[model samples]
Target: MVEATPELTSTSDSPALAVSVLQMLRTATSVQHKALEARLPLTHADLDRSLYTRIIEAYYGFHVPLQRHIDQFVSPQACDPKRYKVAALIKDLRALGLSDGQIDRLPLCCDLPRLQTQGHLLGIMYVIEGATLGGQVLRRIIADRLGIEADSGGEFLDVYGRDTGRRWKAFLKQLADFDQPEYNGDVVDAACATFASFERWLDRAGVLL
Candidate 1:
């Protein structure tokens, strides 16, 4: 789970029935958030190249199908290319010595959560965009412990690079449009489902802590 930093949790300027979407998402998905964080091995002190690669591999598998699915709903104005992380994951895999062919041969997650509306999509995006934060901490850990750098096999850990904050804020700004109470259920369900899906996928891939 991505840490719920203040930036991600601050109350939106616009209150939808006196409760911001951030607040609802944070409160409702707290349990699922902690569960996934506890199970992910990214923070383990002994994280090695093999273990790290497995983790990235699992993420690549998840995002390949996920990105394709989500693109269908995101409008041109809302679809920021920088928000996409699959390419970064692929770059890291290549730096780790995987050939393009091997990457193409990699398996993808099939049982993704259903997204019926843009509200559900927002919840899904919230989870995905929020996870970028863990990368900031991960970059340092992998650098000190595994001798990996963004240009090497750790690009995925710091996908947004120096602009992570800008990207996150952009996502938050986008969320402002869905602050209404009516959208709350889909947002929370999608957020929880995303965490569950990612954790279950990693566990199935044998990469969980």
Candidate 2:
């Protein structure tokens, strides 16, 4: 299981909450981030269909419960429910030729952290949404490596397609609007936990190439 550092009790006097949260997550989760980047199949130059399928399977395992909780806990006003990535994950898995039963049998990350509040939901959203920014780059790399496209096995990484930037900016604007000193610590803690959880999930799913 992934463990986050002890939570801070307060962040009332911190600098801009959104900026601080983002920076704190980047610094605190850097090790996990690098480990995943180094080991994920997409990072390798000699990627193959099997490796790509494994990567997608890992993603499916992590995203299923995460997205479920996000939809359950976060307000639609704060984030568009339609923008959730699980659908893309499922589409990609299907495109990879996994039968329903096979996909059902894929290992799931059952140790996902509880998301109990809007702040917690936002924090999780921060991690998943931020992934899309990197996904833009990964999409291109996967295309070059595996000859995949948005409508094919690349659905998850190619989530936003040409709308990635606009979608990200919109989410950022919404995040900025919801920024509150009282919830700052929760947001940061949630983001960090999300990263750690994802790292652990990937490790468990055997995505280390």
Candidate 3:
């Protein structure tokens, strides 16, 4: 692994970038939810179950990835070359003023087994990996600005990047190629909105402070 000195890029005026990334994350999640929603037979019981799944999946999808990022930041010696993405994410969270406590709790909100069973695991991974990639870029910015190695505070970023890359890529490809008979854009829109809501929550909590 190459230990490059920290190089900070300018993210002072990059709210739009955050919005774009968050939007992508949200839309993909909604696609999975909408698919499940359509599958529920229309009976009251089935409707209830479907609704439950949609709500649960949506909530879990939104928080887990962010939680993973928080977990990665506090640990040292965990960052491998691949975890550059993770480092970048910590930068974003720090920029947002997210406290260690809030960041740490994000994982508990996610359901690991159900995430895989519902086929939304990929979507969740997409959100996490995307943030991680963004984080790497952000870390460079931090390093450049601070005149230190980009991953000075967080090392796990490199570790996660290599480990999650292949699986994340496969998931995205699967999503892009997914050919379902029924197409629902509204669900995608809903997910985007959901993510936006969560982002706002972090902002309000002074995670960016």
TM-score of 1: 0.89
lDDT of 2: 0.77
lDDT of 2 by residue, 100-123 (tens): 899889887888876887777777
- State how far residue 141 of model 1 sits from its true place (Å): 0.5
In model 1, the runs with Cα more than 4 Å from the true position are 1-17, 75-78
- Residue 200, candidate 2: Cα error in Å is 0.7
Give lDDT per model, in order. 0.84, 0.77, 0.39
Q: State the lDDT of candidate 1 residue by residue for 74-107, as single tens digits.
A: 7667777877889999999999888999999988
TM-score of candidate 3 to 2 decimals:
0.38
Candidate 3: list runs displaced more than 4 Å: 1-122, 147-151, 156-159, 162-168, 177-194
lDDT accuracy of residue 50 in candidate 1: 90
Winner by TM-score between candidate 3 and candidate 2: 2
For this target, which candidate reaches the highest TM-score against the unseen true structure?
1
Per-residue C-alpha lDDT of model 3 across residues 136-171, encoded as one tens digit per residue: 553354345433342443332333545456745654
Q: How many clashing residue pairs, candidate 2? A: 0
Our model 1 lands, by Cα RMSD against the true structure, at: 4.5
Query: How big is the positional error of residue 60 in model 1, measured in Å on the Cα after superposition?
Result: 0.3
